[model samples]
Target: MRVQALIFDVFGTCVDWRRSVAREVAKVLPQVDALAFATAWRAEYDPAMARIRGGERGYVALDDLHRENLQRVAAEFSVSAPERLAHAWERLDPWPDVVAGLTALKARHVIAPCSNGSIALMTRLAKHAALPWDCILGAEIAQDYKPKPQVYLASCAALRLATDQVMMVAAHNDDLFAARYAGLKTAFVARPTEHGPHQTTDLGPESDWDVIASDFHDLATQLTP
Candidate 1:
């Protein structure tokens, strides 16, 4: 397969959102269950995006959605300072192999993030995590979220490349499923620890992805120039 670019699914794929957000939660809500709070807050993400994707609401930046969700969960957890806590997402740390792996992958293919995050959120996260990306792509570009064909196609359009020439690299089977439907090449990088030690799903590849890698470094090695 001829591939010229590799677009990543940031959140859990590159940065360990679960742990990073949990760490932040512990700082602000010491008496709360940090991991559980993080999980509850994130659980609100998809349903919130579905509102926009289904046309119930217009496009809202991921950061704003995050803040909204933070407030909702903060109330449930009886936590204060929801605004400051929401900003924690901007400072997520990348998985150990991400920076080095993407650096190597960038040697051959243009690298970017095709995430649901807004450009500002993606940029801050990239800088905080030290990810080497050529550009940011995803929902903000399409004004829609993943699983929506427009999101994937829009990113490909932004790069002026055919969908088939750009591979969607992600850890979730559902994400790969959507990208494959959009006519993009697909690669799955197993991130068993993405959701934490108890992650029951996405522990391994669920389909015949073009490449099934154990980590980003392995993916960089598998991609042909």
Candidate 2:
């Protein structure tokens, strides 16, 4: 069946999370290595989610998890994490191509973020970055994290779409791998510097994803052409 919806991975795919977080850190903690602190804080993200995904913990919003992770990273740096710092995730700037590219795609396909971010987080991030989303869906809807079939399946169900009629667009190959395995079509957009200039992973498509595009603009053309 033809794909009717295009759901995206928001963080590194649509916004520059590393640089954005680093910028926020610099503003709050001028004494520390902001980039390193941002990197370390982000490093705590997956492990925290893994505990939930592994059934070691119950479902929790990512906003709470970010708060917990912030405390941990702050302790490592011997500084108290300011309450406002946790909100940094909500204020990330989008890539230059994102607004226009998504606007183009939104004209033809249902566009929303199927991100790991909680609804509140994604909602604020969307407003802050001016992302044009038809609706919000993802882990919060499924009460689980991605690479899990439930997240992908739940998003499709929420849209009243069959799995095959939805396409998962992400810069991370592993996310696309899981979405495809869960029966969604997949698109890979490279965010080579998501981790930083020295980033070595996901610099290119690792699998033969249904679509591979250089950016969201290229993706819009490829899908709508």
Candidate 3:
């Protein structure tokens, strides 16, 4: 199927989550253990989402999740943080190629972030990074996270496009697999450093994804100009 729109995964895909978090943490607590704090904060992400998904906890937006994780990390490390620190997630710096690559893709297709991030968080991140998305679509709209077929289908439905007409671009293999199962074309862009030096999975494409690229710029090159 010809792709009419490209749906992107924001964190760790378009932006370097580890680096961004580390930088923000360092800025707030220069003498603190930034890397450890970043790692600890990210470690809480999946478990928090799982709780919500498993019906063990109420629905919480990505911002809330980040805040909760940040609080825990700060307490664990004996670091003091201001209330405004949670907004740092929205101020992440994008990968060097994100702007140019997204601009190239936007010239031919509708591009947006279909991520687990909330709309407000994604919006601020896009603006901060100057990510030229036509729109921002998030799990907040679907009330679920990636690896769920419903989130992928919901994005297609919101764009008023068929599943095959849309493509999911992500750094994670599981996310691409979920999109493929939802009947959408898939692109895998490797972000091997996403987990910092402890990276253990997703070193390359794990399935028969439609296309696998070194990064977003490479993915844009593979698609028709």
Candidate 4:
């Protein structure tokens, strides 16, 4: 089926989460260990998401998750953060190719983010990074996260397209697999640095995704008009 729309996974897919968080934290506490702080903060993401998924905790927005993790990491590292520092997650910097690549793709098809981020969080990040999404879709609406078929299908339903008519683009293989299971086309855009120096998985595509690219721009190039 011809792809009518492109849905993106944010965080490490379009934005450099580690680098962006480090940069922002560095601004607030120049002497703080920025890289370590970023990693420590991100370390809590999966466990927190799991808590919600397992019914151990109720649904919490990504922003809240980040803030909660940030506080815990800050105490662990003895880093004193300013009031504005907690908003670092909302101010992530987009990958260099994001704007240009999305601009090129958006010219031909509807583009949006189908992410684990909450609507408010995604909207703020889009405004901060100038992401050219025609719309923003998040798991908050479904009370779930990526790797869940409902999240992918919800995005397609919102766009009024069949599952096969929309494509899911992400840096993670699990995300692509979930989208494929949900009947959407899948694209893998590798983000080798997503998990920083300790990164082990997702260094490259783990599955035979419909399309694989070095980045969004390359994905845009390979996509059919």
What's the lDDT for all of these models?
0.92, 0.95, 0.88, 0.87
- Which one is best on TM-score? 2
RMSD of 2: 0.6
Candidate 4 C-alpha lDDT tens digits along 85-127: 7688788888889999999999889999998899988899999
Candidate 4 residue pairs that clash: none
- Model 1: lowest-lDDT 10 consecutive positions: 77-86
RMSD of 1: 1.0
Q: Which has the better TM-score: candidate 2, or candidate 3?
A: 2
Off by over 4 Å in 1: none
lDDT of 1 by residue, 1-225 (tens): 579999989989998899999999999789999999999999999999999999999999989999999989988988675587888989899989999999999998999999999999999898998998999999899999988999999999999999999999999999999999999999998888877788899888888998999888889888744
* lDDT tens readout by residue for model 2, 1-225: 889999999999999999999999999899899999999999999999999999999999999999999999999999887978999999999999999999999999999999999999999999999999999999999999988999999999999999999999999999999999999999999999999999999999999999999998899999875
- In model 4, how large is the Cα lDDT of residue 112? 93
Top lDDT prediction, candidate number: 2
Better of 1 and 4 by lDDT: 1
Q: What is the lDDT ranking, best to worst?
A: 2, 1, 3, 4
State the displacement of the C-alpha of residue 68, model 1, in Å, after optimal TM-score superposition. 0.7
